[model samples]
Target: MEKILTGTVVLDLTRFFSGPQATLFLAGLGAEVIKIDDPATGDPTTFSPPFAGPEGVSFHRKTQADMGIAYLKRARGKKSVGLNLKAPEGRAAFMKLVRSADVVIDNFSAGVADRLGIGYETLREANPGIVHCSLTGYGSTGPERNLKAYDLMVQAAVGMMSVTGQPDAPPAKAGSPLSDAIAGTFAATGILAALLHRNRTGEGQSVDVSMADCLFALMFDEPFDCYRSLGLPLRQGNRIMRFSPFNAYRTRDGWVVAGAATQDDWNALLRAMGREDLAENPQINSLSWRLANNATVDSLMSSWTEPLESAEVLRRLNEVKVPCSPVREIGEVMEWAQLKDRDMMMPLWNPLAQATVEAKGPGFPIKFSASKAAYDTPAPLPGQHSREVLMNLGGFSAHDVDAMARRGIISAP
Candidate 1:
C-alpha cells in the first residue's frame, strides 16, 4: 500500500524541538525527511541531557550519543545530515536538495534564512512547488521576531505560566514543552494543508508558525472570552474556571481528578458517594449554584473521598459515568494497560544505553485502514547518516563526500 506521504521529500533545516518535531511527524507519515544541521554543533538538543546510558560512561559520551530521551522520542523515522550552512558550497548543496524536495522546514530567526540565501523566496525560485514552513519564536513581522526563545521562555511569555500552578504559589511552567510541541503540530498541519492545496493549484506557499502565537491560541475559547467579556482572568489552578467540581482532589492513596461539569454527572457523583440528598439540594443543584457554593460541595466531596483510595474513587466515578482519572506518575503511566492497549506507548531498544526503554509514541489520532503510521526506526546519532544522505540524496561520489568532510563543511559520526 502507498503511504500517505510516500513520494514526498522534505529538506528539514529545523534544529530544536519545534522544527525537528514537525519534520518528525512528516517522516512518520512516510515522507523522506533529510534533517540538515551545522557541522560544528548539530541540533542544540543533542547537548541538553540527563544521560540515560551507562552509569559513568554516559557523561563522557559525545552530545550525539547523549541526546536527551525527548529528542529520541521525537526524532524517530528521520535521517540526519551535517553541513555548514554558513559556507557557500554547503549552501549550494542544500539548495540542490531543496530543488528536488517537495517541502522545506526551518526555524531560524526572522531573516536568517533570507540572509543565508536559502529563504522561501530563494528556494521557491528553484522549486516553485516547494512548500516552505518557517517557524519562529514570535513571527516574521513581529517586533520580537528576532528574539531567541525556547519552550519555557515562550510558555512564560504567552500567559501559560500565569494560569498554571496553585493560586498562592509563583507562576509555574508546564512540565512538558507544550508551546514548542503545539507549534510543531501547527506547522505540520499547515504543511499538510499546503500540500493539499498544491495538489489542486500546482502552487506552493510559505507557512509561518509562531511559538508564542500557538501558545496563546492554545487557550482557545476561555482566554478570548475572559479578555473580551470579563477583562483579565485570574489563575484558577486545577479547578475549572467556568465549571464547578472539575478539579483534582485528594483521595486516601493519592490524587484523583474528577469532573462533574454537567448536572447529570453531578447527580450521579453525589449518588455514588451516597449523598443523593446533597445532589438534589437547591443550594447545590444547578451549575450556577454549584459554582457559588463550590466550597461546600468541595468540602463534602473531600470528606467522602477521604476514606477511599484514588483507584477506588476513580473506579466508582467511572461506573457512574463521571469523568474521572487517578493521577498517574510517569512510572504508573508507563505501566498503564490502557496506554499499552491503544499503542500510545512504544518500547525501543537503546544500543548505547544497552537497555530497553519505553516512551510515549504519537497519540492514536489518525487511523487509516491501509497505510497506518508507526515508528520504523530510532533517532540517529549526530551525523550518523551524514555520508548516507549526501551520497544517496545529493548523489555525491564517495571522493566528493570525503573532500567536503576534509573542508569542514560536513561531518561523519
Candidate 2:
C-alpha cells in the first residue's frame, strides 16, 4: 500500500525522546526521515543501559553496533546521517539537504538552533516552503527559555510532580517521560499543520513546541480548573476530584480500576454490586454529594471489590456497562491479543540478533482506509546511510564525500 507521506522528506535533528519520537511518527507515515547525529558519539541514548540482546551491555555498546532499546524504540523507520553542523562545510551541506527537504525538526535548548545557523529563518531561506519545528523545554520567548530542562525537570516545573503520588509522600515523577512524548506528538501535529499551510499557500512556518505547555494540557480539565480557581494543587492519588467511585481498588487477586462518571454509570455500578439501595442514599446521591463523602464512597466500593478477584469484579462491572478493567502489567499489554489484532505490536527483524523482534508501534494511531500507515524500517546506526544520502540528496560526488569524511565534517559508516 502507498504510505501517506511517501513524497515528504524530513530532516530529523533530534537527539532524545521528544524530537525523535515526532520524527518516528513521520517516518511511520512514510516520510523519508534523515536522522542527523553527531559523528563522534551519535545520540547519547546509544549508550543507555538495559541491553536487550544476549551479550549484554559491553556487546550492545562496543560490538553489535545496535541501538539501545531507548533509541531503537523511538528512532525506528528513519535513515541516519552524521554531520558536524558547527563546521562550515557541514553547514553548507546541511543547507543543501534542507533545500531538497520538506521539513526540519529539532529538540534543543532555545537559541541553540539559531546559534547553529539551522534556525527556521536560515532553513526557510534555503527552502521557501520548508516546515521547521522545534521542541524546547520552555518556549522561545519565555523567561525560562534559556534554562535547561529534561522530561523530569519540566514535570516538576509544571506542577505535575506536586499533584502526583500520595499526598503524604514527597512529590513523585510520572513513570514515563510524559512531557517529552506528548510534546513530540504535538510537534508532529504542528508540522503536519504547517505542511497543510504550505500546500495551500506555498509558505512554511516554524513550529515552536514547549514541553511545559504540553504537560499542562495533559493535566486534564479538572486539575487545571482546580488549580486556577481554588489556588491549590490537589494530590489525592488516583482519586479524581470531580468524579465519584473513580479509583483503582484492590481485589482479591489483583487491582481493578472502575469509574462512575455519570449518574447512570453510578446506578449501573450499584446495580452490578447489588447495592441499588445505596444509589438513592441522601448523603451520596449526586456527584457533588458523592465527592463530599469520597472516603465513604471509596470504602463502600472497596467493600464490594475486596472479596472478588479482579477478573470477576471487572466482568460483573463490564456486564452492567460500568467502565472498568483489571490493572495489567507491561508484559500483559505487550502480549495483548486485542492490540495484536490492531497491529500495534509489530514484528521486525533484529539483524544483530538474527531474530525477529516484536516492537510495538502506535499502529497508525489514526486509521485511514485509502492510505496505509506502516513502519517501513528499523532505526539506522549512526551515519549508516551517509554515503547514499550524500550521493542522492546532497548531490555530492564520491570524491566530495571522501573529502568531507576525512575533514571530520561527516561520517560514513
Candidate 3:
C-alpha cells in the first residue's frame, strides 16, 4: 500500500534536535516535507559535527563543508529549499509554499517566526486550513519563553537532572538527548491530532510544545509526594519507585538487570536464586515492606548474581520466566541481532565522506499492517530542491526561481 501521508505537504522550518526530530517522523510517514534553510547559511546544524568520520562533527559543506553527523541522521527522507524569509520576495515565496502546504512547523525562539513574518496567523492568512506547530524551549507564553535553550539546558530546567544518576553523584543527563526527543514525539502527536481535526472540520489550529514542559510531564509519572512520604530518596540511581529487586546487579563477567513485576515473578526469581524459603516470610512478601527494604532485596539478589557469570544469571532467570538480561554496550546494541532482524540497521551514504557507512539511523520503530514507513533518502544539500519545489509545488516558474536566486532571496542549485 502507499505510504499513509503520501499526499501531505509540510513546510519545515526547524533546526537542531527538537524541531527536526518532529519533522523526521512526518517524513518517515511519507509527507513531502520541504525543509526551508537560509539560502546562505542553511540550517545551523549543517555547520555544527563529527561527520561520519574529523570531517570532525562547522559540519556542513560538500566541497568545503562536511555534513554534520546530526544532519545526516535527522534530515533523511526530506527535501531542502534554501529560501531566505527575511526579504519581501522571500516572504512572498514562503506564502506561496504555505498555500500548497498542509502543515508548517518551526522550532525557533517564541517570536522568531513572527519576526520572519511566517508565524501561525500569517501562514493562516495564506492557507486557512494549515496546521502550524511551534516547538520551543519553554513554550510561547511563559516568562522563560524567550530564553535561549538547548537540550542540556532544557534537561536542567525541567528538573530531570534532579532525579537522574546516583543521589550522591553530580546529576547527569541521560546518554540520549531525551528532552529533545520526547518533545519532538509530543509535537508530532499534537500535529497528527490537529490534522485529524482539520480533516473533519476544515479548520486548522496551532500546536505549542515546550521541551521543558514535556520532560516535566514525564518526571511526574511517579508520585513524588508519595515517595517522599515513604521516606524514599527521589534519586536512587536504578532503584525504581515502589519496586524492589528491579535494579542492575553485578555479575562475575558484567552487569545483569533482573526485575520482578508481579508476585508470581517475585516467587520465580526467588526460586531461581535458590532462596525459595524467603517466599514464606510475611515481611518479604509484603509490597510495602519490600519497597521500604529494597536495599535488603538488592543485597540478597547481588549475593546470588555476583558470583555467577552474567550469562548464567540470565539463563537461570530466563528458565524460571523471571525477566532479566545482561547490560549491553553501545557497540553491542549497534550489532544486536534483534534490531538488525527488524531492519533497523541502515546504510547511509555521505558524499563528502566519499563512502557509504552503515549508519544506524533513518530507522522508524513503528510498523503498519497496511500503509508504510520510509527512510531511504539522504539529506539534501543547501537549496538542493529549491528550483524543483518552488516550480512544482509553489507554482513558481523556472525563470522566477532563477530571478529569486539572483536576488539572494533563494538558492536554486
On TM-score, the leading prediction is 3
- Report RMSD (Å) for each prediction in the order shown: 2.7, 2.3, 2.1
- The digit string of per-residue lDDT tens for model 2 on 1-413 reads 89989999999999878898898889878899999988887878755754444343333444464346666677678888999998889999999999899999988889999999989889988888999998999988867788888999999998888889876779899999999899989999899999999999999999899999998877865556455575434687887777888888999998999999998998899899999898668667788878877888999999999999888898899899998877899998887888888888765444466655434445556668888787767656678899999889999999999999998889996
Ranking by TM-score: 3, 2, 1
Q: Candidate 3, 388: how far from true, in Å? A: 0.4
lDDT of 3 by residue, 1-413 (tens): 78888899999999998989899999999888999998888988665655553243333433453566788888888999998888899989989989999999999899999988889999898899999999999999978899988889988887778778887788788889999999999998899999999999999999999999999899888787586777877688887775787999999999999898889999999889998899899999877888878889889999999999998999999999998888999898887899888877676656556556444474887889998897758877778899999999989988898889899999887
TM-score, candidate 2, is 0.94
The per-prediction tally of clashing pairs is: 0, 0, 7
Off by over 4 Å in 3: 53-65, 352-354
For candidate 1, the TM-score is 0.91
Pairs clashing within candidate 3: 46-60, 47-58, 47-59, 49-56, 49-57, 50-57, 61-65
Using lDDT as the measure, the top candidate is 3
Identify the runs in model 1 with alpha carbons over 4 angstroms from their true place: 54-67, 224-233, 349-365
Residue 327 error for model 3, in Å? Answer: 0.8
